[model samples]
Target chain A: MVVTQTNHLAGTEALLERGRDLSTPLLRAVVDRLAPPMDTVAAYHFGWIDAQGRPARSDGGKAVRPALALISAEAAGAPPQAGVPGAVAVELVHNFSLLHDDLMDGDEQRRHRDTVWKVHGPAQAILVGDALFALANEVLLELGTADAGRATRRLTVATRKLIDGQAQDMSFEGRERVTVEECLEMEGNKTGALLACACSIGAVLGGADDATADALETYGYHLGLAFQAVDDLLGIWGEPAETGKQTWSDLRQRKKSLPVCAALAAGGPASEKLAAMLAADAKDGDGEHPGAHEDFSEREFATRAALIEEAGGREWTAREARRQYATALAALDGPEGRAMPESVRAQLTELADFVVERRR
Target chain B: MVVTQTNHLAGTEALLERGRDLSTPLLRAVVDRLAPPMDTVAAYHFGWIDAQGRPARSDGGKAVRPALALISAEAAGAPPQAGVPGAVAVELVHNFSLLHDDLMDGDEQRRHRDTVWKVHGPAQAILVGDALFALANEVLLELGTADAGRATRRLTVATRKLIDGQAQDMSFEGRERVTVEECLEMEGNKTGALLACACSIGAVLGGADDATADALETYGYHLGLAFQAVDDLLGIWGEPAETGKQTWSDLRQRKKSLPVCAALAAGGPASEKLAAMLAADAKDGDGEHPGAHEDFSEREFATRAALIEEAGGREWTAREARRQYATALAALDGPEGRAMPESVRAQLTELADFVVERRR
Candidate 1:
């Protein structure tokens, strides 16, 4: 199933290329202008250099946020180029999260290379994350509302949401139990808010009416939720090469992923058994490592996965994601979704499908 | 000595009030619009609330950046109000650094309370810090190109310097050895860049010519260095009640402050002995216990502090700070400085003196 979607996503390269066409020049200029001193350890975290200060090759990411922002903007009737500032802003925010997330998760690997904190140390990584965030804010401010007082209000509101979402996500890390509803709320705020912001900001920049902006925001929000659902699926069942990491890695990390929540929500024998497994994994043992679990034997792992599937975890999520994608499509219910000369709406629909269907 | 300076700084509260008067309304407005839910954590850190999320009196900071900004702008003949955006931006940058510095130093206490990380946890503290940085950028965008694009350019450059300086400061943490030149350069970037940024941004906003902006930048740079030198002195020799932390705490923490650099550079019998003490303290046991030095014999500590003073470190740094302060004052030589209204000039001069003399 993952392989089929991966192949389809490959066909979206042209859509992504169009996004790059809109985003790259502006992003490059921002990066060039804001590049820190070679001596600053945080510079190494940006993947521009090695730990010893030697130059490196492309420190590139998939540019997912940029593509999402641009597609949503175009789907809302604006030309793709109009969303360039927002595309760059969202991408910076994503990268900032990656840098700090690496530190928090203690994952020393990112992009098939040493994570920022692994190579440059946590302090430097923290600063690099900070610099990226500062740049994102600068990008917004750089595109002022022609009215200072009004613009300040909008940007500050958007920024506050971004920060709040991040706080909630981080606070969830050590908690032993969380509900499906809680996880959805977290994803909605942390990941979806920015995606919604990208679309809303794009619509505003495109001079759309308030109704159109709200619709685009809804479309982006639902799309982001669908994207996270797909991501959760990939984390558990992804192929190593496709996912760019080990399979079932989220499970290894004992993350409270969506499927796990679904199993919990089912409240059957499997749910109770899984809860015990999770609780035991989190407990500290006397004079030994407590996170190491002895209860979940290999046979039990297989049964647990089967029970999760039986409980309608992955299937339920996938169906819901498709429904949300359709809803996002419906929200564009006007000339904004259909009027683009380039069949831009079709491209956006395909991209939305790609987000929820991708294995990795 | 530190007590006297604290008393003097207390007297300058009226001047600080004047600085707040320049931009408090806009700053407060921005703070208000920071949006709720997400701002709860940030508000707590800023001392606007208790940890449980109840509102309280706002804990005041010196507002040094805003003060310097307003002073520099007015001295350059720009209306102080015209530079309020720049003032807010610099203050935001200053606060951003403080948030991260507390994390890096592992100093759980800040402003006589638990630091952001201690209260909200590191991850949330990190996000809050990033949010402030983004806010700073938003403030910069508000400045617009009121006088061509020069102010934006100055701000961008200054922000980069602040990041570089902070990066350098963090990088110096793990190293076993450092040179006086390296330490000075680090301090210049860490403490000086933002002060320089405050002045440079102010002058640019005030519509100063390139030459006058450069002069303000120079003034701020030197002033910051002198201020840091005085701070380093008090860090080791000042009273805890005056400095708001333990006396000689920097020495206990093995910080590479200016006086320590001077002592190391002296490189005589006392210097060698001090070196031996530091080396013994760092690696004398199995490398497992860096903090085990808390158990160091009293005789070892007295000998180390004595070696530091006997090397003429304290006196040398004090004189050097005075020299730098004089140099900073000299950098204010310009048409703008000469044109300042007598009242404003006196206030600005007194503010500079107050910064140089601050004990904490």
Candidate 2:
């Protein structure tokens, strides 16, 4: 099993590398079209340059979305090149959201570097994000094909859902109680919609019929949920060295992540204790203690995390991730998936596996 | 001359009314696609509802862009209905910019109502602006025609220029001097590009060829300059009631608008004095007197306004507006313009005239 997992990781890494190789040049070219300051800021955000405009190689997060786009094109029986525009567009959108989300969430760092808003200021962050979004549509529609129109429509619909998800997430921060169902719906919209778009946009661009694109979208949607579940798990219990975040990072922000919601709904003694603790925290934090997370001791956070696990939050989330992974794989066995090249199917399966197993 | 001016005003009002009538329902329908809080916020921003989510009749800005779009379709020998999608898309982009700009500019009120960021907070402002932008592209691409693809490209390109212009505008606020040429370029991007797109997008949707769209685009580009020049005049000189802003509004904000740039370029004792005063204002406002405009006496603003006018700034700006208005009209007599129906050409001419003359 260990050997098989190692091999799968290697294959997925190769796929992601291929995606970055195919999409980065086009992404850079489009970003270059923006005027000076915005272009400089975008380059800095993309990790191609330092804040002072010097060249630097920093971590630009995993190019998983682009890989999905390329693989979807291949599944549609087209060369990966056919998916390059979709890959570039999806990457542009992903970064656009990052720039804005960093500002909205008051996150100062990303990928171990200061965020655009932190370095350049909030206005540039907003304007650069807007410019990137415009570039995404331009990249797709400039293709001037019917497929390009279809792809653009798909991308925009997914973008709206993504925005809706962000709204829901922000609203969730102020509330102490969020149903497990509400948490799942938000995650599905936030991460799932864009990933679903990335997985199928290239297929649409490559002349895949609606049925084929829908099947690929389904595969991606579940993969995103599984990926997000793992992410929630890491947010609580993962190693800070590997995740590049503090222990209980989500808890520090009082995020109503899937595990927290699940644990709250467990309805046991530990769950009740956890609920009372969080409610008190929320009340104290309301106006009395701004930045209250800073006041918590290491032991207190550990206690809360222990209570969450004891209430079966961690187990439930892990099981949910596995169930989602299985569902994503089952999408490949559907009628449309069966029509795709077997090699493409195998690659997609490996990518899904990588998603749930990723450390960061 | 009085009767002719009255007739022109009436004609333009009718055109604007027609534009609003046609675009409002579809715009509302598309906005409704946004989830609750966003949809509510957007509706409030559009003046369809009040702050408490109660129904209210308020001024939505003049639907000038949509009118231009509908007229462009008519110029292409298509009915106004053919331009409905273009009209809706252009309005969405316009509001998207307004929402973000109000936040960045820190303006509290617009059209006699509180700005979105003022009422809903900055995060919602950013998110809703983003959602509107996504909807704009979605509305166009969902048409699923070759014309829709072409139109989407035009709109996205214009949107990029708009973002670029905004970046330039914000940068200019930090500096004491800006050249007239640079000012024109910024306004051309900020206001002109979207207007140009609006004027041509409907033509594209109505099957106009590149040459025809280009001519109409040129017309709208110059018209936008004229419109902005008139707006700059109102910002400094118009009555507060008519303009829905305080007297010397732009000066209070220290905007390096066209008139200021032109006056600074004019090289005279008055110009020199004006430049020195502005430079000192910038220095004093830097960190020592944040929000220093609140401390400026009415006499000081009046004195500055007098200096700008004495240095030929006001005259030059007014003359520039006329120059652009004439140039816009000349576009209608160009080769492509000559092919448009005569009535359409006349309406475009009247619209350009009205743009230069408007008080608000």
Candidate 3:
């Protein structure tokens, strides 16, 4: 299938902006219900405040999931306003995971800011993350509709999958071998499940039929795989200035992301060499623990990244991303998509394109 | 108002045993749905498995919350089976908090066994806690009824309050002064809210009206306060063998538990002395951090406990427990209680008596 290379970046930006406009206020209002320090900490994590608690406008995120939720509602022939709860719920779930994952993964920075755990502490991180998850369900269940109930079940199931993915990812770090299929499965759980939920929850809340929601979910599932592939690529090759990370970040941390898994599974001389180097790194104790790998030099990370690329990891990942992107777009044209408004389909397609092609 | 001193411990045990019989299978089934390591970790936390993953019948806490739920359902004229979902949901939320609280409080032991974070790692603790929370909502939502939806909302709200209470409890540790009222509020949020929900959520699932649920919830709210008061007394003076904690445990940690707060609020000579000692302890760097107070001697803890007792903290706390217990029992005789079956009311009264009188 020939993929369109149209520059929908501007359109996607507008869509994300619209999503932020719709969801941010409700998100803020919900978070404000958190008691004292949790509220302040959540505000800091959302970039609504400086570390000192002064109000500031910093990058929260792209609001990609919320945008998808809003569009999915439109796809179900409902007004965007009908999907606000879904949008906010998914956004809350997304941020909730971000908070805990930052602590679990020992990530110090996100969106060019110190992580919640880093800024406040690990206890606050755990508590605030939990509070947000509870708020996500509250936002849905408070609607007191049958559709809202259905949407809550969907969001919670997705959350479990997201958590399952995290467990798998953490487990993979200790093992010397991880198959490409396993890596993809982990990514599917960690990132794909929630995205899939976000893509269809709006439709579910808008009182759409199961078929339409399923179709939108399928579209989102593929989009999520594609998004993870791109993210894996950028972890190694993207510019630090754009990505808000250092050079060869994943390689430096020895994360067994998609690219590394694919290349290790390739089984060539360079792949074997890469595997040995990684195994040795794991033996050095730094690989066993997160945030303990700072001893690796830039030159070492460069060498590892180059070996991964030479073993065809980079090329394979890029191709997989494009293939997934094509599949995601094809979902929008299927039988269920026929019922969606043409404008909604166009917006979803634009967003998918932006997801696959963006630098960060 | 005369309080009965009749012994109902035997009947309460039977009731709890029935609750455990009804809820454990379903709880295990739900927890089994967690992926891999999480399932294993949760199994370990629930005391169904040893640290080595072999089966073991460890000391899981008394099934107090589940019993409350089942009895609440009975109060609404529904069979105990009707409250199974509510029972499992509250139990899950309770365990979720325990897993996180152990890590945050740096408590290495629980119920004569190592805590989840102590046995597993902190990441597993956080992840397993999160998974259990998600599972709680899922179990209720999977029932697929409006009552189930309402119960889920109630559970989530209680969960949020539980988290809020934890935040307050943690913040209290670093402060030099904490009021009796503030301590009570923290306990209410941390312990009372979940108990309140447990007491009413079953009625909600059994299609009870707002008046019934409200009355039951009030009963639970006071019962929780009574429970906390007893817990505070035990924290200071209960036998280590029965309580599974060291002697003067709260004082060793320099905790501002209800007893400490009440003693400080008394304003007598002993209260002033106790305040000075605690303030000095706070300045000694141990109070600022949990698990960092090992330097305090046994004699030091004994002296602190004696000071608290001398300041009427112990007597006041015991009286408060009795007062709350009376209030809790009185709820069953209120107007809303008139609709409840006589047997259910008797069972609830029995449970309340056991709660305030239990040694552990």
Candidate 4:
């Protein structure tokens, strides 16, 4: 799954850059008046220094959701700047879910640092999440465009899907096993829905027709599934140095990743291996086996990863993602592309590749 | 303190009944659509029945916030139907707070049974809370005839306040002491903000003039403060049998309630007694004298309650509550009580009395 890097992100990077720019200014402006203390927590969660308002370099994530939104708008033939507000809205919504997810998952770390819940405590973390959700709506409302209300409705609908997805994820926590179809359905809601919303919203904001917006939505949906598949691959198989964490991390957590599930269903050496690993991990509460799985050389997990590849899971998912990206590009064709200008559309195309191929 | 219970909810109860009639159909409609498993949890939380959805004759509290909203709408000259959405909206918001509060506070019991978190577990309890929050917004959006965008904005604003209040409350935890002014500010954000929002939103939905809406908001503001004071009093001095909980429970928890702080500040015999109790409790926590405060006895706590009255804390707070209730009623300004012809407004007034006058 190794791929060469390209430097054609000028347009996509701009979209990502624009997204990062919009969130803080608009959020600060709103909370500065309504609820000043919230800005402290919001700033912190956004990876801005401390609650003390110190300036610090922070690694904001890929901003994939916001990128999809802006790129969709440009692809739908609207000026790139036209989708700025919607981009900000989608990004805020994404961060909102991340905040709550940390609390519910009881994950102590995120983005290579203490999670919002761990540092500030759960109550504050929950409030910060709520505040971000509110601010997303507020930003949409204040966009001052004619479609602001429509954009809000879209955002709200997408958020509901995200919440539903979170519920489904939580429901699986104590379950013995989950079907592949059910897993796909959960990913559709948790991951795909937001990505779809990003593109659909961008199209709508850019004055794209209903049919075109729907096409872009379909594209984003497929892209999301593939993105998660690759993410699952990296969770266990990616380079330790490149991924900035540890190899086989997901396996250690018994996270039922796509590869693990595929291997479990293989009914051979992989299945036997997975069954034994599951039993060992099932004794999770006592914490008696801290690092026990990692003690078993990565060879077995690597073999399992190879089995996932042989099962064609990674290639199948990647093909689906590419299909979606192509469909999105196709939807941007004809008179609409003429309106957006060729240079802009080219930039957005590169952004689509960025979405599906990123290592991190 | 020994007054009869007659006419306690004279005004508020009528308004509550009318509100119930208007909102039940819509709420029931939504409840019926909830996923079976989630619905089971929600039903239990709503006091419907023990997970089986049987008809339980449980009292679902006073429904004070919704009643105030309806009464304010009527007082501002809107029809009963006009206030119905606001009624349901306020009630849902209240319940959302309760769901999360139970989890954050680690309260094991509520409404004479296990709390929602206790029954459903923390993760599911969180999901339920999220579901309620989303439903509240969804319901607001479903009001076809209402100004959906405006309604959404108003609701979001109110929700932001609620979150801010929760943040402030959490901030108070583990703090040694705080000033009365800070306490009042926190109470306003936590307890008063939503109540005020209820009245203000009802007025907006009912087509009330800005001036009238502002007055109704003021009414609710004062009313909420009064209600909290009375509740604080009940936590200390109310009978355990009547209150349906242990007497002086707040004191046992070492909660920084208004009466406790007031008595401590007076620096007299009552203050001295409170200091001794607090020191003993602190010692117990340090393992210096295990359960030292447990030996103080409930009778001594009752005597401490007498000291609160001597410090003028109870009387001062009660007077404040009465004044707020009077202000809310005065805002109506109906000729011989003719403005609010519906029973709903009357019930709301009774509910206000319940807030300030409840022995519990």
Rank ordering of all candidates by TM-score, starting from the highest? 3, 2, 4, 1
Best by TM-score: 3
In order, what DockQ does each candidate have?
A: 0.25, 0.81, 0.86, 0.41
TM agreement with the true structure for every prediction: 0.79, 0.97, 0.98, 0.85
Q: What is the interface RMSD of candidate 1, in Å?
A: 5.0
Clashing pairs in 2: none
Q: Ten residues in a row with the worst lDDT in model 2 chain B?
A: B284-293
| A1-360 per-residue lDDT for model 1 (tens digits) | 333565557657777777767897786667665434423444455556676778875446556677766765665577877778777877766777778766765666665577877775667677777666656656755564442222223444555566666555555545667788887887787667777766666556666666666666777788888888877777777676776665465665566677877777878776787777666656742212112333455565556566667777777777767777777777666655444335655666667767776655
Better of 2 and 4 by TM-score: 2
- Candidate 2 chain A: minimum summed lDDT over ten consecutive residues — where? A284-293
Q: Give the per-residue lDDT digits (tens) of candidate 2, residues B1-360.
A: 122788798899999999999988999999999987999999999999999999988999878999999999998899998999999999999999999988777777788778998898888899999999999998988888889889999999999999999988888888889999999999999999999999999899999999999999999999999999999999899888887777788888888998899999999899999999999988877622125487899999999999999999999999999999889889989999999999999889878877887877
Error at A262, model 4, angstroms: 4.0
- Candidate numbers sorted by DockQ from highest down: 3, 2, 4, 1
Summarize candidate 4's per-residue lDDT along A6-59 as a digit string, tens digits.
565565677677765654465456545435456777777777776457876677
* Deviation (Å) of A169 in candidate 3: 0.3
Best by DockQ: 3
In the predicted model 1, the residue pairs found to clash are none
lDDT of 1 at B318: 86
